[model samples]
Target: MKLPGIKGFDEEALKKYFKNTGMLLIGKVGSLAIKMLSSIAVANYLLSYGNGILTTSVSYVFLFAALAGLGLDQFIVKELHQYPEKREQILGTAFSLKSFAGLICIPLIYVAWLIYPLEGIKYSHIFLLSFMGIFQSFTIIDSYFQSEVKSKYIMQVQIIGNLVSAAIKVGLILMHSSITFFFIAYLFDTILLSAGYIITYNRKGRSIFNWKYDFSLAKKLLTLSWPLIISGIMVSIYMRVDQIMLKQILGDKGIKEAGAYNTVVMFSEALNFVPIAIVSSLFPAILNARRDDKVRYQKRLQNLYDLMVWLSLSFAIFITIASPIIYKLYKPEYISAAPVLSVHVWGSTFVFLGVASGQYLIAENFGHLSFIRTGLGAIINIVLNILLIPTMGMMGTAIATVSAYFASAFFILFIPKLRQQGIMMLKSLFLVTAFQKIFKR
Candidate 1:
């Protein structure tokens, strides 16, 4: 008789699973290493003020970039999996729509640049960051490789692009390049990544040019993804809006204050790849299981939650304890940020669980609920930042972030639709249930 709840995977399927995940994990490490080194170079060369400018500019661009994406990247990934035979049409249409969205975002960037109150940021920074969003629009190409379970090609191209970008960054620091040069390096990296995608696509005997846009296709994808667009903005708000809030509230020392928070966030941000890479590699399998076996699907998701939570807690604890040493890896001037990093890294626990639960939202087609949860979190973060930043400064900012993350990830238990997922997240958080389930198998 067949056992219930636990679906056994054949050896071949298991091998393929690890192969896809292993390649991406390795690439993430290489990419993370290069970026950390680059961050060190920039932190020292630009100092606090410059680093703040970099962080804020990217954050500003990212929000609008999400709007420009029209949520098509994710829509494409989902559609591709369900209808692999329509790959050409889906990819072609997504590229066309995404490119148009990228173009539209250009003028929007100018509007933001003109209306933005801060005179502290340079125009070149605005211009470079605006275009960075446009280049990022091309990343729908990466989504195509993902649908085919061919992450190895994407990994190779990403590493090559990162290596080139790292070399450029190193040279800029050695030559004492202006901030514009650094911006150029940033833009160039995106260009190379897009080019790399195209190169790999062609090498595999496919042509991006063959892809065409279908209005009906666009409408269908958008129908499913518009919530994501709004949710994306809300997510962006809570994630990056703290820097803006701190910049404004901190008065004359605004830029430096933002830099201080960002310095601490950088280390935490580097490790975010752990959850993203894991989810990306396994999500297709999860999708398949959702159709074939609900019990097994739930079990796999629980396993993911368990891994995400334990790993996040482990990282948070280690980073909190070693914050002083981590700070020393940056310039001595940034040593004050050690406590900030210590306080801030704890947010990673909730962030990881949030990410894991978010997969359930997508797989189960609870996109509206996803938005509600994240939107609520964003509002909470903003209010907390406004109330707390003046008195507590960066410490208050850290607390606000952690609070918002907890609210988003765990507060969903009260919602009727998301109640089960929330309980699963809680199980992952405590580990007792999750561990029992694991060893019982």
Candidate 2:
């Protein structure tokens, strides 16, 4: 039997499915546009060096935040699907565990600061930024909204919070505030955003906290999350190691250069959020399809690959062409970022493909594949950085990042089937394009 929502098995139903999917894409794009504009403002106000400090600080925060949650986000998303009746218990245990985990992270944050104190800041910024991890732990609630596919709530929360945060940061800069003010604004943003999510949950007639802990469930969560924890660490390393390496090798000045390059590179990341949101919604649907019909499972996976490639290529081309104009509009000093953007935007194609494949693996309860793929990318990134950064500088990092992503993407395609799956994807694309042309004519 076919799954209830799988493909619709007819043109009209399929059209409706695609339309809904497009709506999700449009919502995500709208939110990302707001974020991108705000980011450009921040980049303009903050010089390359200042932007570097901001990016590096956030990277460290993300690393710690991931550690603080101990991979519970992924665990919750995965296991929650299996135990709908235990929703309250599962959410409560995860929340309580994360809160306790956040407390433990306090001392750990201090030690980390002592070990690696960033330049030009007192301990205050460090202290404030430390709360970022704790604040992020509340994101566990996000999975609940996601599972239900009520993405409008998540989008509303993110858009409002981001706008408010951007306004605060921009106002601070206009007032000639110190960099410390920027950091403070960021912390305040997270705190307020977390509160907003909690309030929203409460207003929906759902209690924000059950405050009950189940030791057995917690252990199961931890066991499932272990691989994700490793994957998280690997992802963190790959994402931030370039800046960290630049800082170590070339000092503050080097970081400034790398930061400028990364500003442009990361602009493409806004595009990534759309695909992530789509995949998040589709995951449960795909999982259900896989369980119901084997042939539909293969067809759905193939369709996903086809859709990803089309989207990835279009974005890659647009960004590659627009890089120069985008840099010019941002600021004159940021022109140097164009080449980096060109190289980095192409990386998005690889990233999108890899993520689509990774979702399939996750739906199959093959989370370990995610660990392996990301781990390989991380390893390749580090090795390339060590080898290339001294000689080529920021360009080296850009090259390394692109190379790592491409390797990971190809690995996903290859390890599944050496040649057959590759041919299948190409054939699907060809058929899609030919059909489009025929309809137009």
For every model shown, what is its TM-score relative to the native structure? Answer: 0.94, 0.88
Question: How does each model score on lDDT?
Answer: 0.80, 0.71
Identify the leading candidate in terms of TM-score: 1
Worst 10 residues of 2 by lDDT: 1-10
**How would you encode candidate 1's per-residue C-alpha lDDT over 1-441 as one tens digit per residue?**
322212344456557765787877887788878878887878878988888887777777777866777767767877887898888889887777767777888788788778875557777676776776666656777788777777788889888888889899999998888888887887788888889988899899988778777789878888888888888878888988888888878865767778878877788766887887777767877778888999878878877787788778889999989898887777777887888888889999898888888878888788777778889999999999999999888788888998989998887799787788888788768776655756787
lDDT over C-alpha atoms for residue 88 of model 1: 80
Error of 1 at 117 (Å): 2.5
Worst 10 residues of 1 by lDDT: 1-10
Clashes of each: 0, 0
Total clashing pairs in model 1? 0
